[model samples]
Target: MPTETSSLELVGVLDELTPEKEKYSDALKAAGEGFVEAYNIFQDADFVTKKGWKSELSKDDATVHSKNLSFGHVFALRTTLPVPIDIAFRESFLNFDDLATWSENITFSKTIAKLTDHVDVVHYANPDVAVVQSREFLVARIWRKVDDDIYVSARSVKLEHVPTAKGRTRGHLHLGCARFSPDPTDANKTTIDYLLSIDLKGLIPKAIVNLTMAKIILKDFTETKKHYANVLASENAQTHELEHHGV
Candidate 1:
């Protein structure tokens, strides 16, 4: 009994689809490109999700199938910074209390907040249901130290829902936590692992959901993984210099 008209609007809309699926392949490609660009800009940024409802076409009278459009998948990626156990304990423990300070001082925190705001604006303009959710501070519940390495786990969530006719819904839900630990084998190294499980439901096709999920994960993983690598490299370089100087 939902409206028949398309209630969802994509932040980045696809051009006209050709009758021939092959000819319309470009649409999918374009969507992929745009997703990557937007995702990179907003990932790790702090933001909020806003929700509301509006009327659309009556479901009973509509003839256009909702399947023809593309709504991207949902995913999550996390970065773990390697800190000495003592430092980790201090940082993780103080994260909550220092959240305000972190937001004011950390460059990444500011970047994340900006990204979330951008996503909100984009989603609002496009009209599809989209949300950006982030924790003010990293939550550390699980901590393990193997050899010289230390591992810590944290959690967060993001959800997007787009309602359609035919009792179908298209959206993305990303959940799970990330684990970060020092590299036992490397004295100057750290390892980070991010695990995210995805769930999609409603009248949407399984195939489409699966594909979008993959794309979302791929984009997020790549960007976050790269960020971690950069942080590790910087830490390693600093550690080496200190040793050389006998600090």
Candidate 2:
């Protein structure tokens, strides 16, 4: 019952609403390269140790590792979460903006631009902890899925449209990547490998930065695990109640 012109107008509206497929394609390519490099570094046992990646903390199934690079420090963590890969990937990357609500370490987070379904520009700020100063980062992120595994990579990028927030030191994230894969042994679990290279540009001492960084990564994973566990519990409870009522 729609007129030809009305249908055309509707198509135009949908076009505007949908992100351009080719937008930020070059950035996505670069991020892919970075991801490959990070994956290689993390997988190379010798290279990781050569880079001074020492085991900082090992608790339960989670292990945190750290190393010092010339430009900044790098941290890596591996853990298994009691959630499916798709849900873990969505919560960690697609729902990144929602992280501020559940993450106390991050005070502010906003997606500056979504270049495509797989690429975006984000700005997030972390509150000051101990001797560390308040810091913010503007990053370009790219994510992709291979088979059942999902990989996401991000790095600092300068965009004229997104200006620096006042009263916050802009930090440089050389590279950040997270890989989510279904645990082969457990169908309901996902294994995550998180690697990040960052330099909090300020007068903060290296010791303080390293300590805080380690704590932040560990806490982030723990919080994410706890959040999903609670969500699944609540969902199961609701489903049970509905089943009892024959809904």
True-structure RMSD, every candidate: 21.0, 7.6
- The true-structure Cα RMSD of candidate 1 reads 21.0
Candidate 1 residue-wise lDDT, 83-195, digit = tens = 44344434432232342342222212211111111111011001122232221221112233434433332222221221222333323222222334555654334334333
Maximum-TM-score candidate: 2
- lDDT by residue (tens digit), candidate 2, 1-247: 4322211111112111133434444454455556666766656775434456688776667878887665456789987788988778877789989989887778888987776556677899988877787789988787766667777888887766678899888988888888888999888899888888788887777778888787778777887887788767887999999999999
Report the error of model 1 at residue 90, Å.
12
- Residue 154 miss distance in model 1 (angstroms): 6.9
What TM-score does model 1 achieve against the real structure?
0.31
Name the lDDT value of residue 16 in candidate 2. 17
TM-score of each prediction: 0.31, 0.81
Local distance difference test, candidate 1: 0.32
Alpha-carbon runs more than 4 Å astray in model 2: 1-30, 45-52, 58-60, 69-72
